[model samples]
Target: MWKFYLFLLPIFGVNISGLYAKNDQKIILATYTYDTKDRIENLLPFADLLKSRFEGKFEIETKSFPSVDELILAMLKKEVDLVFISTAGFLSYIDQADEFEIAGTLMVDQESESTYRSIIAASKLSGINSWEDVKSKSKGLKISLVNENSTSGYLLPYLHFQQRGLTPFKDNFGLVEFTGNHKKSLDSILTGEFDLAAFGENDLQNLSGNEDLIHILWVSPAIPLGPVMVRKDMDKSISEVVEQNLLNLHQSYPAILESIKAGWIEAQNASHFEKLTKDFYIDFLK
Candidate 1:
Protein backbone atom coordinates (compact mmCIF):
# COMPACT_ATOMS: atom_id res chain seq x y z
CA MET A 1 0.00 0.00 0.00
CA TRP A 2 1.19 3.57 -0.77
CA LYS A 3 1.03 6.20 1.97
CA PHE A 4 1.45 9.89 1.21
CA TYR A 5 3.43 11.77 3.85
CA LEU A 6 2.42 15.38 4.48
CA PHE A 7 5.17 17.86 5.28
CA LEU A 8 4.81 20.41 8.07
CA LEU A 9 5.93 23.21 5.76
CA PRO A 10 4.46 23.97 2.36
CA ILE A 11 6.31 22.32 -0.55
CA PHE A 12 7.49 24.77 -3.17
CA GLY A 13 6.24 24.18 -6.71
CA VAL A 14 9.06 23.15 -9.04
CA ASN A 15 8.53 22.48 -12.74
CA ILE A 16 8.64 18.69 -13.26
CA SER A 17 9.90 19.05 -16.84
CA GLY A 18 13.30 20.40 -15.78
CA LEU A 19 15.26 18.93 -12.83
CA TYR A 20 13.06 15.83 -12.39
CA ALA A 21 12.19 14.63 -15.88
CA LYS A 22 12.94 10.93 -15.22
CA ASN A 23 11.72 10.32 -11.65
CA ASP A 24 8.14 11.57 -12.26
CA GLN A 25 9.10 14.82 -10.49
CA LYS A 26 8.98 13.41 -6.96
CA ILE A 27 11.77 11.52 -5.19
CA ILE A 28 10.13 8.31 -3.97
CA LEU A 29 11.58 6.84 -0.76
CA ALA A 30 10.68 3.18 -1.14
CA THR A 31 11.22 0.97 1.91
CA TYR A 32 9.97 -2.40 3.15
CA THR A 33 7.44 -1.76 5.94
CA TYR A 34 6.78 -5.42 6.66
CA ASP A 35 5.86 -5.01 10.30
CA THR A 36 2.80 -2.88 10.97
CA LYS A 37 4.27 -1.55 14.21
CA ASP A 38 7.37 -0.36 12.34
CA ARG A 39 5.20 1.67 9.97
CA ILE A 40 4.33 3.92 12.90
CA GLU A 41 7.41 3.49 15.08
CA ASN A 42 10.35 3.52 12.67
CA LEU A 43 9.14 4.42 9.15
CA LEU A 44 7.21 7.58 9.98
CA PRO A 45 10.16 9.23 11.69
CA PHE A 46 12.58 8.09 9.03
CA ALA A 47 10.36 9.51 6.29
CA ASP A 48 9.94 12.76 8.21
CA LEU A 49 13.74 13.10 8.51
CA LEU A 50 14.17 12.71 4.75
CA LYS A 51 11.44 15.24 4.03
CA SER A 52 13.06 17.68 6.47
CA ARG A 53 16.52 17.21 4.94
CA PHE A 54 15.49 17.56 1.30
CA GLU A 55 12.80 20.20 1.95
CA GLY A 56 11.49 22.02 -1.15
CA LYS A 57 14.35 20.98 -3.45
CA PHE A 58 12.95 17.45 -3.87
CA GLU A 59 9.33 16.41 -3.36
CA ILE A 60 9.85 13.19 -1.37
CA GLU A 61 7.14 10.55 -0.80
CA THR A 62 7.33 7.17 0.93
CA LYS A 63 5.92 3.91 -0.43
CA SER A 64 6.08 0.25 0.58
CA PHE A 65 6.48 -2.76 -1.74
CA PRO A 66 5.26 -6.34 -1.16
CA SER A 67 8.37 -8.07 -2.44
CA VAL A 68 12.00 -7.51 -3.40
CA ASP A 69 11.34 -7.90 -7.15
CA GLU A 70 8.70 -5.18 -7.12
CA LEU A 71 11.05 -2.88 -5.23
CA ILE A 72 13.85 -3.42 -7.76
CA LEU A 73 11.37 -3.10 -10.65
CA ALA A 74 10.32 0.31 -9.34
CA MET A 75 13.94 1.46 -9.60
CA LEU A 76 14.25 0.00 -13.10
CA LYS A 77 11.15 1.94 -14.16
CA LYS A 78 12.49 5.16 -12.59
CA GLU A 79 9.41 5.34 -10.40
CA VAL A 80 11.47 5.02 -7.24
CA ASP A 81 14.64 7.04 -6.52
CA LEU A 82 15.79 5.08 -3.49
CA VAL A 83 15.11 1.78 -1.66
CA PHE A 84 15.83 0.38 1.80
CA ILE A 85 16.13 -3.33 1.06
CA SER A 86 17.60 -6.48 2.60
CA THR A 87 21.07 -7.90 1.97
CA ALA A 88 19.70 -10.86 -0.03
CA GLY A 89 17.67 -8.47 -2.19
CA PHE A 90 20.75 -6.31 -2.78
CA LEU A 91 22.78 -9.37 -3.88
CA SER A 92 20.23 -10.16 -6.58
CA TYR A 93 21.09 -6.84 -8.25
CA ILE A 94 24.85 -6.92 -7.78
CA ASP A 95 25.53 -8.09 -11.35
CA GLN A 96 23.57 -5.16 -12.75
CA ALA A 97 26.21 -2.84 -11.35
CA ASP A 98 25.45 -0.02 -13.72
CA GLU A 99 21.84 0.35 -12.57
CA PHE A 100 21.96 0.38 -8.77
CA GLU A 101 24.34 1.79 -6.13
CA ILE A 102 24.57 1.25 -2.39
CA ALA A 103 23.66 4.36 -0.41
CA GLY A 104 24.59 2.95 3.04
CA THR A 105 24.11 -0.08 5.28
CA LEU A 106 21.76 -0.10 8.31
CA MET A 107 23.51 -0.50 11.66
CA VAL A 108 21.15 -1.77 14.39
CA ASP A 109 22.76 -0.57 17.66
CA GLN A 110 25.67 1.26 19.30
CA GLU A 111 27.76 -1.80 18.41
CA SER A 112 27.24 -0.79 14.74
CA GLU A 113 28.04 -4.34 13.71
CA SER A 114 26.13 -4.26 10.40
CA THR A 115 25.50 -7.97 10.92
CA TYR A 116 22.68 -10.27 12.17
CA ARG A 117 21.71 -13.93 12.49
CA SER A 118 18.93 -16.27 11.42
CA ILE A 119 17.22 -17.96 14.36
CA ILE A 120 15.33 -21.24 14.06
CA ALA A 121 12.70 -21.44 16.77
CA ALA A 122 10.24 -24.16 17.63
CA SER A 123 7.44 -24.61 20.15
CA LYS A 124 8.01 -26.85 23.12
CA LEU A 125 4.70 -28.49 22.28
CA SER A 126 6.19 -29.61 18.98
CA GLY A 127 8.65 -31.85 20.86
CA ILE A 128 11.57 -30.39 18.95
CA ASN A 129 14.35 -29.42 21.33
CA SER A 130 17.59 -29.35 19.40
CA TRP A 131 18.87 -28.81 15.85
CA GLU A 132 19.28 -32.57 15.50
CA ASP A 133 15.63 -33.05 16.45
CA VAL A 134 14.65 -30.51 13.82
CA LYS A 135 16.71 -32.39 11.25
CA SER A 136 15.17 -35.74 12.21
CA LYS A 137 11.61 -34.74 13.12
CA SER A 138 10.34 -31.71 11.21
CA LYS A 139 8.28 -33.83 8.83
CA GLY A 140 4.49 -33.21 9.00
CA LEU A 141 4.98 -30.20 11.25
CA LYS A 142 3.51 -26.87 10.30
CA ILE A 143 6.35 -24.46 9.47
CA SER A 144 6.43 -20.72 8.88
CA LEU A 145 8.94 -18.31 7.33
CA VAL A 146 8.92 -14.58 6.56
CA ASN A 147 9.31 -14.92 2.79
CA GLU A 148 11.65 -16.12 0.08
CA ASN A 149 13.35 -12.73 -0.06
CA SER A 150 13.88 -12.49 3.72
CA THR A 151 17.53 -12.85 4.75
CA SER A 152 17.02 -14.37 8.20
CA GLY A 153 13.49 -15.65 7.66
CA TYR A 154 14.12 -17.60 4.45
CA LEU A 155 17.48 -17.14 2.68
CA LEU A 156 19.80 -18.06 5.53
CA PRO A 157 17.48 -20.82 6.70
CA TYR A 158 17.33 -22.19 3.16
CA LEU A 159 21.11 -22.30 3.00
CA HIS A 160 21.25 -23.88 6.47
CA PHE A 161 18.81 -26.63 5.52
CA GLN A 162 20.60 -27.27 2.23
CA GLN A 163 23.90 -27.73 4.03
CA ARG A 164 22.26 -30.39 6.20
CA GLY A 165 20.90 -32.17 3.09
CA LEU A 166 17.32 -31.05 3.61
CA THR A 167 14.96 -29.48 1.08
CA PRO A 168 12.95 -26.85 2.99
CA PHE A 169 9.49 -26.48 1.42
CA LYS A 170 9.69 -29.68 -0.58
CA ASP A 171 10.44 -31.97 2.36
CA ASN A 172 6.85 -32.94 3.13
CA PHE A 173 6.39 -30.61 6.07
CA GLY A 174 2.68 -30.45 7.02
CA LEU A 175 2.64 -26.85 5.89
CA VAL A 176 5.39 -24.53 4.71
CA GLU A 177 4.02 -21.03 4.85
CA PHE A 178 5.30 -17.56 4.09
CA THR A 179 3.82 -15.14 6.63
CA GLY A 180 5.38 -12.09 4.90
CA ASN A 181 7.28 -10.80 7.95
CA HIS A 182 9.31 -12.14 10.88
CA LYS A 183 6.88 -10.87 13.52
CA LYS A 184 4.01 -12.75 11.94
CA SER A 185 6.08 -15.90 11.52
CA LEU A 186 7.19 -15.84 15.15
CA ASP A 187 3.68 -15.05 16.32
CA SER A 188 2.28 -17.98 14.39
CA ILE A 189 4.82 -20.25 16.06
CA LEU A 190 3.89 -18.91 19.49
CA THR A 191 0.15 -19.28 18.92
CA GLY A 192 0.25 -22.95 17.89
CA GLU A 193 -0.40 -22.30 14.23
CA PHE A 194 3.16 -23.34 13.44
CA ASP A 195 5.40 -25.93 15.02
CA LEU A 196 8.51 -24.08 13.85
CA ALA A 197 9.52 -20.78 12.28
CA ALA A 198 12.70 -19.10 11.12
CA PHE A 199 13.26 -15.37 11.57
CA GLY A 200 15.81 -12.77 12.58
CA GLU A 201 17.17 -13.00 16.11
CA ASN A 202 15.96 -9.46 16.73
CA ASP A 203 12.39 -10.61 16.18
CA LEU A 204 12.89 -13.17 18.93
CA GLN A 205 13.75 -10.45 21.42
CA ASN A 206 10.18 -9.22 21.30
CA LEU A 207 8.99 -12.63 22.47
CA SER A 208 11.00 -12.55 25.70
CA GLY A 209 7.86 -12.82 27.82
CA ASN A 210 6.99 -16.19 26.29
CA GLU A 211 10.27 -17.90 27.06
CA ASP A 212 8.54 -21.00 28.32
CA LEU A 213 6.62 -21.49 25.11
CA ILE A 214 9.33 -21.59 22.45
CA HIS A 215 12.79 -23.00 22.03
CA ILE A 216 15.44 -21.57 19.72
CA LEU A 217 16.68 -24.65 17.89
CA TRP A 218 19.54 -23.02 16.02
CA VAL A 219 21.14 -19.73 15.09
CA SER A 220 22.99 -19.24 11.84
CA PRO A 221 26.34 -17.51 11.55
CA ALA A 222 26.39 -13.73 11.32
CA ILE A 223 25.38 -12.15 7.99
CA PRO A 224 25.79 -8.59 6.75
CA LEU A 225 22.91 -6.16 7.30
CA GLY A 226 21.08 -4.81 4.23
CA PRO A 227 21.98 -1.52 2.60
CA VAL A 228 20.01 1.41 1.27
CA MET A 229 20.20 1.40 -2.55
CA VAL A 230 19.61 4.13 -5.09
CA ARG A 231 19.29 4.34 -8.84
CA LYS A 232 22.45 5.36 -10.72
CA ASP A 233 20.77 7.91 -12.95
CA MET A 234 19.56 10.14 -10.09
CA ASP A 235 21.07 13.62 -9.81
CA LYS A 236 24.57 13.38 -8.35
CA SER A 237 23.94 16.34 -6.05
CA ILE A 238 20.74 14.76 -4.72
CA SER A 239 22.56 11.48 -4.04
CA GLU A 240 25.31 13.27 -2.12
CA VAL A 241 22.74 15.09 -0.04
CA VAL A 242 20.90 11.87 0.84
CA GLU A 243 24.18 10.09 1.68
CA GLN A 244 25.40 12.84 4.01
CA ASN A 245 22.04 13.09 5.75
CA LEU A 246 21.99 9.35 6.54
CA LEU A 247 25.65 9.11 7.72
CA ASN A 248 25.03 11.84 10.31
CA LEU A 249 21.48 10.75 11.22
CA HIS A 250 22.28 9.19 14.60
CA GLN A 251 23.73 12.35 16.09
CA SER A 252 20.83 14.48 14.84
CA TYR A 253 18.01 12.01 15.49
CA PRO A 254 18.87 9.51 18.19
CA ALA A 255 15.20 8.71 18.92
CA ILE A 256 14.51 7.93 15.28
CA LEU A 257 17.61 5.76 15.10
CA GLU A 258 16.64 3.89 18.27
CA SER A 259 13.13 3.33 16.91
CA ILE A 260 14.48 1.45 13.91
CA LYS A 261 16.85 -0.62 16.10
CA ALA A 262 19.85 1.72 15.50
CA GLY A 263 21.31 4.27 13.13
CA TRP A 264 23.33 3.68 9.94
CA ILE A 265 27.05 3.82 9.18
CA GLU A 266 29.10 4.01 5.96
CA ALA A 267 28.98 0.76 4.01
CA GLN A 268 32.23 -0.82 2.76
CA ASN A 269 30.92 -1.57 -0.74
CA ALA A 270 31.56 -4.85 -2.64
CA SER A 271 34.59 -5.81 -0.57
CA HIS A 272 32.42 -5.85 2.58
CA PHE A 273 29.91 -8.03 0.79
CA GLU A 274 32.56 -10.66 0.01
CA LYS A 275 31.77 -12.56 3.22
CA LEU A 276 28.06 -12.82 2.47
CA THR A 277 28.34 -13.36 -1.30
CA LYS A 278 31.46 -15.48 -1.66
CA ASP A 279 32.21 -16.98 1.72
CA PHE A 280 28.70 -17.66 3.12
CA TYR A 281 27.42 -19.54 0.10
CA ILE A 282 30.70 -21.15 -0.91
CA ASP A 283 30.92 -22.82 2.48
CA PHE A 284 27.38 -24.14 2.14
CA LEU A 285 26.61 -24.49 -1.60
CA LYS A 286 29.85 -26.32 -2.29
Candidate 2:
Protein backbone atom coordinates (compact mmCIF):
# COMPACT_ATOMS: atom_id res chain seq x y z
CA MET A 1 0.00 0.00 0.00
CA TRP A 2 2.83 2.42 0.78
CA LYS A 3 4.55 1.60 -2.50
CA PHE A 4 1.29 2.07 -4.41
CA TYR A 5 0.73 5.40 -2.66
CA LEU A 6 4.21 6.59 -3.58
CA PHE A 7 3.67 5.44 -7.17
CA LEU A 8 0.51 7.54 -7.38
CA LEU A 9 2.44 10.80 -6.88
CA PRO A 10 3.86 12.42 -9.98
CA ILE A 11 7.61 12.56 -10.55
CA PHE A 12 9.34 15.01 -8.21
CA GLY A 13 10.19 18.54 -9.25
CA VAL A 14 9.58 20.86 -6.30
CA ASN A 15 11.96 20.54 -3.35
CA ILE A 16 9.85 20.37 -0.15
CA SER A 17 12.00 21.63 2.67
CA GLY A 18 12.10 21.32 6.50
CA LEU A 19 13.39 18.51 8.70
CA TYR A 20 11.05 15.59 9.39
CA ALA A 21 9.13 16.02 12.61
CA LYS A 22 11.07 14.31 15.38
CA ASN A 23 8.07 13.78 17.68
CA ASP A 24 5.82 12.07 15.12
CA GLN A 25 4.22 15.44 14.43
CA LYS A 26 4.85 15.71 10.72
CA ILE A 27 1.99 17.24 8.69
CA ILE A 28 1.19 15.48 5.45
CA LEU A 29 -0.75 17.69 3.04
CA ALA A 30 -2.64 15.64 0.47
CA THR A 31 -4.75 16.15 -2.64
CA TYR A 32 -6.01 14.05 -5.57
CA THR A 33 -7.74 16.09 -8.25
CA TYR A 34 -5.83 17.95 -10.96
CA ASP A 35 -2.46 16.88 -9.62
CA THR A 36 0.59 18.26 -11.40
CA LYS A 37 4.21 19.04 -10.77
CA ASP A 38 3.59 22.74 -11.26
CA ARG A 39 0.85 22.73 -8.68
CA ILE A 40 3.27 21.07 -6.29
CA GLU A 41 5.85 23.74 -7.06
CA ASN A 42 3.33 26.43 -6.31
CA LEU A 43 2.57 24.82 -2.95
CA LEU A 44 6.24 24.51 -1.94
CA PRO A 45 6.50 28.05 -0.65
CA PHE A 46 3.27 27.54 1.27
CA ALA A 47 4.73 24.43 2.85
CA ASP A 48 7.82 26.35 3.82
CA LEU A 49 5.60 29.04 5.30
CA LEU A 50 3.82 26.40 7.35
CA LYS A 51 7.15 25.07 8.55
CA SER A 52 8.20 28.53 9.64
CA ARG A 53 4.86 29.18 11.35
CA PHE A 54 4.97 25.89 13.23
CA GLU A 55 8.26 26.94 14.90
CA GLY A 56 9.76 23.44 14.81
CA LYS A 57 6.66 21.84 16.28
CA PHE A 58 5.82 20.17 12.96
CA GLU A 59 7.19 19.20 9.52
CA ILE A 60 5.40 19.34 6.18
CA GLU A 61 5.12 16.75 3.41
CA THR A 62 2.89 16.84 0.34
CA LYS A 63 1.26 13.82 -1.24
CA SER A 64 -1.04 13.25 -4.20
CA PHE A 65 -3.62 10.46 -4.28
CA PRO A 66 -4.71 8.65 -7.43
CA SER A 67 -8.37 9.40 -6.71
CA VAL A 68 -10.63 11.18 -4.23
CA ASP A 69 -11.58 7.77 -2.77
CA GLU A 70 -7.94 6.99 -2.10
CA LEU A 71 -7.51 10.36 -0.43
CA ILE A 72 -10.49 9.65 1.81
CA LEU A 73 -9.07 6.24 2.64
CA ALA A 74 -5.79 7.81 3.64
CA MET A 75 -7.62 10.27 5.87
CA LEU A 76 -9.71 7.50 7.45
CA LYS A 77 -6.54 5.56 8.15
CA LYS A 78 -5.02 8.63 9.78
CA GLU A 79 -2.21 8.78 7.23
CA VAL A 80 -2.87 12.14 5.60
CA ASP A 81 -2.67 14.99 8.10
CA LEU A 82 -4.54 17.50 5.91
CA VAL A 83 -6.13 17.82 2.48
CA PHE A 84 -6.75 20.42 -0.23
CA ILE A 85 -9.74 19.05 -2.08
CA SER A 86 -12.32 20.33 -4.58
CA THR A 87 -15.84 21.19 -3.45
CA ALA A 88 -17.19 18.04 -5.07
CA GLY A 89 -14.56 15.87 -3.43
CA PHE A 90 -15.19 17.64 -0.11
CA LEU A 91 -18.95 17.01 -0.26
CA SER A 92 -18.30 13.36 -1.05
CA TYR A 93 -15.85 12.90 1.80
CA ILE A 94 -17.51 15.15 4.44
CA ASP A 95 -19.84 12.22 5.21
CA GLN A 96 -16.87 10.97 7.23
CA ALA A 97 -17.10 14.10 9.34
CA ASP A 98 -15.81 12.17 12.31
CA GLU A 99 -12.41 12.02 10.63
CA PHE A 100 -11.97 15.57 9.38
CA GLU A 101 -12.75 19.27 9.95
CA ILE A 102 -12.89 22.16 7.54
CA ALA A 103 -9.74 24.22 8.08
CA GLY A 104 -10.52 26.80 5.40
CA THR A 105 -11.97 27.42 1.95
CA LEU A 106 -9.88 28.87 -0.90
CA MET A 107 -10.98 32.30 -2.07
CA VAL A 108 -10.19 32.56 -5.79
CA ASP A 109 -9.45 36.28 -5.99
CA GLN A 110 -8.79 39.40 -4.02
CA GLU A 111 -12.28 40.87 -4.46
CA SER A 112 -14.77 38.12 -5.02
CA GLU A 113 -16.77 36.70 -2.09
CA SER A 114 -15.60 33.15 -3.12
CA THR A 115 -16.46 31.69 -6.51
CA TYR A 116 -14.76 30.77 -9.77
CA ARG A 117 -15.64 29.34 -13.17
CA SER A 118 -14.95 26.29 -15.28
CA ILE A 119 -13.72 27.31 -18.70
CA ILE A 120 -14.11 25.59 -22.05
CA ALA A 121 -11.54 26.29 -24.67
CA ALA A 122 -11.37 25.34 -28.32
CA SER A 123 -8.45 25.29 -30.67
CA LYS A 124 -8.46 28.22 -33.06
CA LEU A 125 -7.93 25.79 -35.89
CA SER A 126 -10.93 23.65 -34.85
CA GLY A 127 -13.34 26.19 -36.45
CA ILE A 128 -15.28 26.30 -33.16
CA ASN A 129 -15.28 30.03 -32.79
CA SER A 130 -17.99 30.68 -30.21
CA TRP A 131 -20.74 29.31 -27.98
CA GLU A 132 -23.07 29.03 -30.97
CA ASP A 133 -20.60 26.62 -32.57
CA VAL A 134 -20.72 24.42 -29.48
CA LYS A 135 -24.52 24.31 -29.16
CA SER A 136 -26.57 21.19 -29.86
CA LYS A 137 -26.60 22.13 -33.53
CA SER A 138 -22.97 21.11 -33.80
CA LYS A 139 -21.91 17.50 -33.26
CA GLY A 140 -19.05 15.06 -33.74
CA LEU A 141 -16.40 17.29 -32.20
CA LYS A 142 -13.62 15.65 -30.23
CA ILE A 143 -13.26 16.87 -26.64
CA SER A 144 -10.99 16.23 -23.70
CA LEU A 145 -12.21 16.54 -20.10
CA VAL A 146 -10.54 16.33 -16.74
CA ASN A 147 -11.44 13.60 -14.21
CA GLU A 148 -15.11 12.98 -13.41
CA ASN A 149 -14.36 13.87 -9.78
CA SER A 150 -13.12 17.32 -10.72
CA THR A 151 -15.64 20.02 -9.76
CA SER A 152 -14.56 22.75 -12.17
CA GLY A 153 -13.16 20.42 -14.75
CA TYR A 154 -15.99 17.89 -14.99
CA LEU A 155 -19.09 18.67 -12.89
CA LEU A 156 -19.54 22.28 -13.95
CA PRO A 157 -19.24 21.39 -17.64
CA TYR A 158 -21.64 18.52 -17.19
CA LEU A 159 -24.18 20.79 -15.50
CA HIS A 160 -23.84 23.36 -18.25
CA PHE A 161 -24.45 20.77 -20.93
CA GLN A 162 -27.44 19.39 -19.04
CA GLN A 163 -29.12 22.79 -18.69
CA ARG A 164 -28.69 23.39 -22.40
CA GLY A 165 -30.99 20.47 -23.20
CA LEU A 166 -27.98 18.73 -24.78
CA THR A 167 -26.46 15.48 -23.65
CA PRO A 168 -22.71 15.03 -23.94
CA PHE A 169 -22.35 11.36 -24.95
CA LYS A 170 -25.76 10.94 -26.53
CA ASP A 171 -26.08 14.22 -28.37
CA ASN A 172 -23.22 16.26 -29.74
CA PHE A 173 -19.82 14.72 -29.31
CA GLY A 174 -17.90 12.17 -31.35
CA LEU A 175 -15.25 11.49 -28.68
CA VAL A 176 -14.91 12.31 -24.99
CA GLU A 177 -11.80 11.43 -23.05
CA PHE A 178 -11.38 11.83 -19.30
CA THR A 179 -7.71 12.80 -19.41
CA GLY A 180 -7.49 13.07 -15.54
CA ASN A 181 -5.55 16.38 -15.36
CA HIS A 182 -5.96 19.94 -16.57
CA LYS A 183 -2.57 20.10 -18.26
CA LYS A 184 -3.19 17.11 -20.53
CA SER A 185 -6.68 18.24 -21.46
CA LEU A 186 -5.53 21.78 -22.27
CA ASP A 187 -2.39 20.61 -24.04
CA SER A 188 -4.34 18.13 -26.16
CA ILE A 189 -6.78 20.78 -27.33
CA LEU A 190 -4.07 23.39 -27.94
CA THR A 191 -2.05 20.92 -30.00
CA GLY A 192 -5.10 20.25 -32.16
CA GLU A 193 -5.21 16.68 -30.89
CA PHE A 194 -8.70 17.47 -29.59
CA ASP A 195 -11.25 20.10 -30.50
CA LEU A 196 -12.38 21.21 -27.02
CA ALA A 197 -11.27 20.97 -23.41
CA ALA A 198 -12.83 21.94 -20.09
CA PHE A 199 -10.95 22.81 -16.89
CA GLY A 200 -10.76 25.37 -14.09
CA GLU A 201 -10.57 28.95 -15.33
CA ASN A 202 -7.63 29.63 -13.02
CA ASP A 203 -5.91 26.48 -14.26
CA LEU A 204 -6.13 27.73 -17.83
CA GLN A 205 -4.60 31.06 -16.80
CA ASN A 206 -1.87 29.31 -14.84
CA LEU A 207 -1.04 27.06 -17.80
CA SER A 208 -0.88 29.67 -20.56
CA GLY A 209 -0.36 32.84 -18.45
CA ASN A 210 -2.44 34.50 -21.16
CA GLU A 211 -5.42 33.82 -23.42
CA ASP A 212 -3.84 34.19 -26.86
CA LEU A 213 -3.29 30.47 -27.33
CA ILE A 214 -6.82 29.09 -27.46
CA HIS A 215 -10.26 30.51 -28.19
CA ILE A 216 -12.61 30.69 -25.24
CA LEU A 217 -15.77 28.74 -26.01
CA TRP A 218 -17.84 29.12 -22.84
CA VAL A 219 -17.55 29.82 -19.11
CA SER A 220 -19.74 28.06 -16.60
CA PRO A 221 -21.50 29.75 -13.69
CA ALA A 222 -19.64 30.43 -10.50
CA ILE A 223 -18.81 27.44 -8.30
CA PRO A 224 -17.55 27.59 -4.72
CA LEU A 225 -13.99 26.48 -4.08
CA GLY A 226 -13.43 23.71 -1.55
CA PRO A 227 -11.87 24.02 1.88
CA VAL A 228 -8.56 22.92 3.32
CA MET A 229 -9.58 20.01 5.51
CA VAL A 230 -7.52 18.67 8.40
CA ARG A 231 -7.57 15.37 10.23
CA LYS A 232 -9.75 15.71 13.32
CA ASP A 233 -7.49 13.66 15.54
CA MET A 234 -4.34 15.66 14.82
CA ASP A 235 -2.67 17.38 17.78
CA LYS A 236 -4.76 20.38 18.79
CA SER A 237 -1.86 22.78 19.23
CA ILE A 238 -0.46 22.01 15.78
CA SER A 239 -3.91 22.02 14.13
CA GLU A 240 -4.77 25.39 15.66
CA VAL A 241 -1.54 26.92 14.39
CA VAL A 242 -2.14 25.47 10.93
CA GLU A 243 -5.72 26.76 10.79
CA GLN A 244 -4.84 30.25 12.01
CA ASN A 245 -1.94 30.52 9.59
CA LEU A 246 -4.09 29.35 6.68
CA LEU A 247 -6.74 31.95 7.44
CA ASN A 248 -4.14 34.73 7.54
CA LEU A 249 -2.23 33.60 4.44
CA HIS A 250 -3.34 36.56 2.34
CA GLN A 251 -1.46 39.01 4.51
CA SER A 252 1.24 36.75 5.96
CA TYR A 253 2.33 35.26 2.65
CA PRO A 254 0.71 36.98 -0.28
CA ALA A 255 2.76 35.11 -2.85
CA ILE A 256 1.60 31.75 -1.55
CA LEU A 257 -1.95 33.06 -1.47
CA GLU A 258 -1.55 34.18 -5.09
CA SER A 259 -0.15 30.81 -6.08
CA ILE A 260 -3.23 28.99 -4.80
CA LYS A 261 -5.73 31.60 -6.04
CA ALA A 262 -6.96 33.04 -2.75
CA GLY A 263 -7.35 36.53 -1.29
CA TRP A 264 -8.58 36.53 2.32
CA ILE A 265 -11.40 35.21 4.45
CA GLU A 266 -12.15 33.90 7.93
CA ALA A 267 -11.55 30.22 7.21
CA GLN A 268 -12.12 29.22 10.82
CA ASN A 269 -15.65 30.56 11.07
CA ALA A 270 -18.62 28.24 10.66
CA SER A 271 -19.94 27.99 7.09
CA HIS A 272 -23.33 26.84 5.92
CA PHE A 273 -23.09 24.20 3.19
CA GLU A 274 -26.84 24.04 2.84
CA LYS A 275 -27.07 22.08 -0.40
CA LEU A 276 -24.77 19.32 -1.58
CA THR A 277 -25.97 16.22 -3.35
CA LYS A 278 -24.99 13.52 -5.84
CA ASP A 279 -27.80 14.99 -7.95
CA PHE A 280 -25.42 17.67 -9.28
CA TYR A 281 -23.15 14.90 -10.55
CA ILE A 282 -25.36 11.83 -10.37
CA ASP A 283 -23.95 9.91 -13.30
CA PHE A 284 -20.49 9.52 -11.77
CA LEU A 285 -21.03 10.36 -8.07
CA LYS A 286 -23.78 7.74 -7.70
Q: What TM-score does structure 1 among the candidates reach?
A: 0.71
Model 2 C-alpha lDDT per residue in residues 1-286, reported as the tens digit of each score: 2242233222321122322233465788887634533255556677877766554446789777777778778877878887877677877676565677777765444424433567888977688887778774357688888887777778778777777655655557888888887778888877889888888765675765546668987776556566677776665555665676677666656667766652211221222222223334333333
Clash count for each candidate, listed in order shown? 0, 0
**How does each model score on lDDT?**
0.64, 0.65
Instruction: For candidate 2, report its TM-score.
Output: 0.62
lDDT of 1 by residue, 180-255 (tens): 8878888887887789999887767667789788998778766666777667776665665566556655665556
Question: What would the TM-scores of all predictions be?
Answer: 0.71, 0.62
Cα deviation of 33, candidate 1, in Å: 2.8
lDDT of 1: 0.64
- Regions more than 4 Å wrong, model 2: 1-24, 32-35, 38-59, 66-69, 95-98, 108-116, 121-139, 168-172, 183-193, 202-217, 235-237, 253-286
